[model samples]
Target: MKKIAVVAANGRVANKVITEAVSRGFDVTGFGRKENNTKAQHYVQKDLFDLTSEDLKGFDAVVDAFGAWTEETLPQHSTSLKHLCDILSGTDTRLLIVGGAGSLYVNKEHTATVMEGPDFPDAFKPLASAMGKALGELRERKDVKWTYISPAGDFQADGERTGKYLLGGEELTLNDRGESVISYADYAIAMVDEIEKGNHIQQRISVVRA
Candidate 1:
């Protein structure tokens, strides 16, 4: 079985990703600030900044689900990816980032990003912009294979898993209700599917419910 490691494994989305990967029979390990209730083969509680290259060499892929909205931790999003790239350089392991939708285009012409629009909430800007910056960091790295998955603007924590979703490029996708939305469960499905298929290498992809 392919081995995968999930960082920030205690979060809601990470939990669903772990569950989905486990259901697919992948050998899974989890890393987080504290032990979480998970069925992974192993779990490591450590600060993400403290991780070394040797600590990550065992996994076939690393899912970076690390998230933060605070002023102190937000910058870590870029630094964490940088650290991982430095360590995973020249290795075959892939880095799959759980990205934000802020950077996605609000229009079909790709003229403006979601964060640039008037409707986007002010409270969410910091986290969304930080995630966008992290994606920028990933884009500059040449030695690492990375994929960033951006969910819909209305990413719901209580959404259901129908094992169904649609993939999009940098443009935002909206449902019949004209709202961009996705469930965490379905997002996890797309993530593990990408992990197995590896169809989106060194690219940014988006997901929304079908």
Candidate 2:
């Protein structure tokens, strides 16, 4: 059984990912600030602010599902992502991260630019932009096997897992409806599947409902 470690397991996507991983017979471990109420038997309660490389040993893969929306939290998020990269550097373990859609491309001439438009939230622009930069940096690194998965633009709270999705590389992918959307459950499934198969390494990909 492959051992998978998920950071920020309390979030909606992480929770579903953990559940799907567990169901698939993977030995799942969760690292987060608070104890997750899910059925994951191995839960490590630790603040990401205090986490070190030493705390992340013996895992085949690490899924970073951490997210933040405030300027104060951007530094922590960036630091944690770098720390995870550092820990997995030179190791065979993979880092699967939940990335933002704002950085994705909408067309050949325009990118799904965030923080530059009027509708972009002033408070969240910094955080989103920071995440985009962090992901870009991770792509340049050669030591760790990292894959960033960005959800579609229509991501929301409740959606059913149809076990159907479209996958694409750095270029943003959309469904037949001309919108990008995937349920938390299906997103979790895709993350685990990528981890197990080591697909799309060192690249950022997007998933949307088909």
Those runs of model 1 whose alpha carbons end farther than 4 Å from true positions after fitting are none
RMSD of each: 1.2, 2.1
Off by over 4 Å in 2: 109-124
lDDT of 1 by residue, 1-210 (tens): 999999888999999999999999999999888866777778998877788888899788999998888988899889888988888898899999999999998777887999989998999899888888889889988888899999998999999888888899889988667768899999999999999999888999999998
In angstroms, the error of model 1 at 62 is: 0.6
Minimal lDDT window, size 10, model 2: 110-119
Instruction: Please name the candidate that would achieve the greatest TM-score relative to the true structure.
Output: 1
Winning candidate number (lDDT): 1
| Per-residue alpha-carbon lDDT of candidate 2 for residues 85-194, written as tens digits (9 for 90 to 100) | 88778888888999887677656775656446566677666877888888777778899888999887667658998888888766668788887678888887788889
Q: Relative to the unseen true structure, what is the Cα RMSD of model 2?
A: 2.1
What TM-score should be assigned to candidate 1?
Answer: 0.96
Cα error, residue 207 of model 2, in Å, equals 0.2
